[model samples]
Target: MNSFGQAVDASNLDKDVKSTTLHSVGDAAPDFSCRTTDSREFKLSAQMGRVVLLYFFSSSNPACFAQMKYLENEVFQKLRRRDDFQMIALGRGHAREELVQIGGEHRLTFPLAADPKQEIYTRYFSKYVPRIVVLRWDGSIAYQASGADYEGVLRLQEVLARELAAARTR
Candidate 1:
């Protein structure tokens, strides 16, 4: 069951969808900077003292859309007000203009970035859409998930909560 007490059907997820990620839990997250759809600069290194969530998706993938919706509705809504939390949804291989249009169409409230050349996305993973990476306050990777499945999304929420609590105590 998910946080909302709904049953998550994982059987519908594509079995072949897997993450070929280069980073692992406890590894230092790669730092990069980019301009968000809102014209704000986002630098991973600058978010050192905060828990950062990086969401990579493709605008052309329907499964990615589903995951994006979950992040926006379930994750973003609950954590947007936290000063120690930052979320960036990046369009893998998409240009800034495309991300801006997508943000407007989806009414996304969080920062939307564009990785037109896959520069940022390639640093984390070589394949897979709807990938999520959670960085600890100290710039290490705390959690990562691949595919647009509820199980992954739920796990991300759990990891984020735990990481945030741990950060608060530091």
Candidate 2:
């Protein structure tokens, strides 16, 4: 069983979608810096010692919205206060103002970043909305999941808990 109490075979996630990410688990996570909706700079390389969750989404995709809702309600709410965890939701091809508006509409507490040119998104996948990538404390990719579904979210929750626990012990 996974963190959400369902039997989750992480190995069985949609195969085709799973292969979409350019970087795989254990690979070094690509580094990038972007201005967030809140006007703060988010640099992935600076977050080395903490577990990081990168969520790439499109503001116009309904499936992405569903996934974002689950993340805000289920994941972010519970982990927001943790000093060792960071979550950033990147809006692919979205302007800063648009991201700000979306964040307000969704009541998202996590940082919403703007990747208006696909500069960041293309480094991970050529196409896909609601792509999730979890990076370990050492800056390596720990997990990757795609799609807007409960199972993917649950798997992410499980991986996050495991990674956070592992980071604590190191």
Candidate 3:
């Protein structure tokens, strides 16, 4: 739980309480049947066996942009090459071309997608920008954040660590 007394249970908590509960955590991640820059259908549930970073943000928000920039340096690059993990950049505020450009500019090899009307964000928040909800290979919620939650940043690594450990086991 955060210092704000948010439940962070990993599943459904009252929107008023703002607590995501254990059920929410283990529940099937809300699927994204959205289009990507590659014209590919990016469905969250389809990639069930892969570790995922369900990254949400708005290009117009500076904090979101800053968080992405920081992540590009701190988290993205380090996690980029892992075969078990993948990132899907989702939001409504940017055009598909613009999002593709951002990915190209950042040398991102991951899927940069558009949810122009925010079908995905509403599944997660009533309000908030740069909300990142991470997921495990089984398609369960691992962690989430809004704005610049650097303290919560380590949540990003949960997948990679699990994947690496699995790879070593194999």
Best-performing candidate as measured by TM-score = 2
What stretches of model 1 exceed 4 Å from their correct place? 1-19
Per-prediction TM-score to the true structure, in the order listed: 0.88, 0.88, 0.73
lDDT of 2 by residue, 14-129 (tens): 45456766888999999999988878999999998899999999866677776788888888889889888999999999999998888889888889999999999999987667
Residue 154, candidate 1: alpha-carbon lDDT: 77
Model 2 CA lDDT for position 131: 84
Candidate numbers sorted by TM-score from highest down: 2, 1, 3
Model 2 lDDT, residue 18, Cα: 60
Q: Write the per-residue lDDT of candidate 3 for residues 51-81, one digit (tens) a residue.
A: 7777777766656666677767777678788
Candidate 3 local Cα displacement, residue 143, angstroms? 1.2
Model 3: lDDT to the true structure: 0.67
Better of 1 and 3 by TM-score: 1
Evaluate residue 33 in candidate 2 and report its C-alpha lDDT on the 0 to 100 scale. Answer: 96
Per-candidate total of colliding backbone pairs: 0, 0, 7
Q: Rank the candidates by lDDT, best first.
A: 2, 1, 3
Q: Write the per-residue lDDT of candidate 1 for residues 65-119, one digit (tens) a residue.
A: 7677778999999999998999999899999998888888888888999899999
